[model samples]
Target: MAVTKRVVLHFPRRLVEQPVIYRLVKDYNLEFNILRASITAEPEEEGLLVLQLKGEQEEYDRGVKFLLKSGLKIQSLSQDVTRNEARCTSCGACVTLCPPGAFVVDPKTRQVNFDDEKCVACGLCIKACPPRAMEVHF
Candidate 1:
């Protein structure tokens, strides 16, 4: 079966220049979508990458093992971005800011709806929410 997972990868200075993603694809036969990345050219700086990876379950496991052996610190992006219904005023502030379109406005009721499955935990909603209804649990 195929599986998809979001993960954060921290690359030490030594591995910053390596083609880790390329290896994941070529060697492990895994596909990835890079959500965000910050890697400086300076040799002294470390790199950070957020990715959504997909592959067969066994291939995914092998890819993870490869990452660990390559000296990358990996963390599952299981962080939750939640909305407090009580505090939510149905304002559509989050609708435009959410990268994944996790928030939508109900046309009939003019109420805002949130889909947790669509959230990517980018935290943009938390900062944009006027009522402080959005919360991030890391």
Candidate 2:
């Protein structure tokens, strides 16, 4: 079965320069879409990467195992951020705060639309929402 999974990867300072992502494609036959990345060239600082990986279920599992063996800390990107429609007032408070533009206003309807797929669970919208419509769930 084919599967796609979003994940967060933590790279230790020592492994930051390695071609870890390349191995996923060449050895594991996985496809990846990078959502966000914060990598520092400094030798003392660690690197962080958020990405969606897609492949067969068996291949995905193998790729994840490779990441673990390479000393990378892995976390599921399952932090679900949702907006309560009843509590939302289309105030557009979260429109500007979202980093990925997950919230957008319909030009004609003047209503806010939430695209959950684009959200990175940054929690900025949750804090900016006046009606407390935005929420994050682990």
Per-candidate TM equals 0.74, 0.66
Over the stretch 11-120, how does candidate 1's per-residue lDDT look in tens digits?
Answer: 98888779999999999999999877888887777798888999999999999999999999887765556789999999798898888998989899999999876777
Q: What is the C-alpha lDDT of each candidate?
A: 0.86, 0.87
Q: Candidate 2: which stretches are off by over 4 Å?
A: 42-44, 80-92, 95-118, 121-138
Candidate 2 minimal-lDDT segment of 10 residues: 75-84
Each candidate structure's count of clashing pairs:
0, 0
Q: Give the TM-score of candidate 1.
A: 0.74
Candidate 1's C-alpha runs over 4 A off are: 41-45, 80-90, 104-114, 121-123, 132-138
Given candidate 1, what's the lDDT at residue 119?
A: 71
lDDT by residue for model 2 over 27-129, one digit each (tens)? Answer: 9999999877888888787798888999999999999999999999898875566788999999898898889798989999999999877787777888789
Q: Residue 105 in model 2: shift from native, Å?
A: 12
Error at 5, model 2, angstroms: 0.6
* Residue 77 displacement (Å), model 2: 0.9
